[model samples]
Target: MKYLEGIAEFCAVADVGNFTGAANKLDTSVAQISRKVASLEKQLGVKLLQRTTRSVSLTEAGTQYFQQVLPALKVLEDAQLAVSALQASPQGLIKLTAPVAFGEAFIAPLLNTFMQKYSGISVQCTFSNEKLDIVEQGLDLAIRIGKLEDSTLVAKKLATRHLFVCGSRDYFKEQGQPRSIEELKEHSLLVGSQPYWRLFIDNKIQSIPVQGRVRYNSGNALCSAAVAGLGIAQLPGFYVRKALASGQLIELFPEYKDKQEAIWAVFPSNRNVAPKIRLLVDFLAQHLVSDS
Candidate 1:
C-alpha cells in the first residue's frame, strides 16, 4: 500500500466522518476509499475507524492517532509544497528587516552579492533598531542579533557577533586597562542599551554590570567614543574588528572573552513560505558561514 495514499484516505474519512462522504470529497468510490483505509489499518496494525450501517465514528485509539497523523500529514504536504516552490523560479520581492548596524555592516554587503547572483530576485531591505512584527508588517525575513526572547518567530543561526571590551591606546595609557571585571569600575566606561555586558572567564559565562559616564543607544557611537579616548566600551566584534587590528583600540581582559555573540535570521511560521525568503535565509547562512 502507498503510505501517502493511505494517509490521504484516513484523513478523508476522518474529516468527512463517513466513507461515502469521504469518497465524495476525494472523487473516488466509497469502496475504493474503504479499501484504502483498510489497507492503511493493516499496514499500521491498528484499527483506525469504527463503522456501522447508520453511522461511522473513530475508536479511542483511532481518535488519538488521528490527532497526531492529521498534523503530521499537513506538515508533510507543506514540505512537498516547499520543495516544489524551490524548483520554480525565484522571482519575488523579499521584504526583509534587520538591525540598523548589522544590516549596514554585514547584511547589506551580502545582499549586494546575493542580488548579483540571483538577478530575478529583488529585495527590499529595511534597517531599524525597533523590532517590527514580521507577519503584521508583511515582511518575509528579519536579521536578528543576540539571544532572542520571543518564541513566536522561527530563527536560524546565521553568524556570531562577538562582543569585545576595548578602548583606544591613548585612553588605555591614561586610564589603564581593566585587570578583571571588578577593575572596570575604576575607569570611565562607554555603555550601550544594556547596563550589563556578557563576558566569559576561564570557561564560565558572567554578566557584569558597569556604570559609564556616557551611554549611547547606538553601538557605532559607543565605538566612536572609545576610539576618541572617551572611555572603554563593550562593543560587538563587527564594529571593533578593524580598530582592534589597527591598534586604535586594545581588547581589555583577554582572560574573560566570550567566543562570539550569536546572530540569527528569523521568519514568521506560516503555510507556503516564499521561495525568495527561503533563498535569502539559506544564502545568508552559507555566505556568512563561509566567510567565518
Candidate 2:
C-alpha cells in the first residue's frame, strides 16, 4: 500500500518517459511529482525508474508492477464511469481515425448524424491506412478493419465484412471462369495495391499471386472497373453487393471468399473510457450493420 502513493505519477512517467510530462498529465508540479515518486521508491525499496538526463524508463520490476496496477486502475475507472454514465453530458471534441475508403463510405455519414444528435460534441477524423500510434498521437479512438495486430489497445468489434473475387458476366464469358487458384493466371486479374489476393482454399488461407491489365489502389475504382466489364477484381462485400445483385458483376469462386473480417473500434488501454467516447462507440456499434 505504501508503494501505491505515486502509482499514477509513475505510470504517467512510464507512458511519456519524463517527469515533466507526468506532472503535466496529472496537473501537479514537477517537484511534487518527483518527491512523490522518490518516496514511493523508498517505501518499496526498489528503483522502479531508470532515470537519464533526457528520458526515464521502467526497470524490470517497474514494468511488472505497472502491468499489474494498470488493470486494477482501469477497473476502478469503469466503476466510476458506470455510476456517472447517466449524469454526465456528452460535450467534447473527439479525435478518431479509420480506413480511408470505409470511413468515406460508411463512418463519415454516421458521424454526421451523431454530431447532430449530440449538439455539444464535435469530431476530428483522420482517414489513413497506416497504423498510427494512438497513444503517442493522442487519438481518442481508431476504427480498424480486417485482422488486428497484437497491441495493448482495447478493441470492440463494431461490424463484419467479407471479401470476394468478382468480375462482369461479359468478362467471364470471354475469358472463361477460373476453376482453380492456378487458373487465375490464365485470365485478366485486376490487381490492387497488394499484388497478391488472399483466398480460402481447401479449408486453409492462401495468398495467391495475381496479375492483370489494370491496377488500382482504390476499392471503389476497382469495383467500377469490374462493373464496366474491364476485368476481374477482388473487393469487399460492401463495394460489390449492389453490382452483384444487379447482375452487373458476377462473384467468382463463390465458395472461396475469405472468412468474415471484423471492423473494430480501438482505444488506448491506459486511458479511462470517458462518457463521450463510450457514447460514440455505442452509437457506432448500434448503427454499423454486422451482415456480410
lDDT of each: 0.80, 0.84
Off by over 4 Å in 1: 1-88, 289-292
TM-score of each: 0.69, 0.75
| Candidate 2 local lDDT, residue 271 | 86
Worst 10 residues of 1 by lDDT: 268-277
Candidate 1 on 179-245: residue-level lDDT in tens? 7777888899888998988899668787888787899999889989999999999888878888999
- Model 2 CA lDDT for position 90: 76
Residue 263 error, candidate 1, Å: 0.9
Clashes within 3 Å, all models in order = 0, 0
Q: Kindly report which residue pairs in candidate 2 clash with one another.
A: none
Q: What TM-score does model 2 achieve against the real structure?
A: 0.75
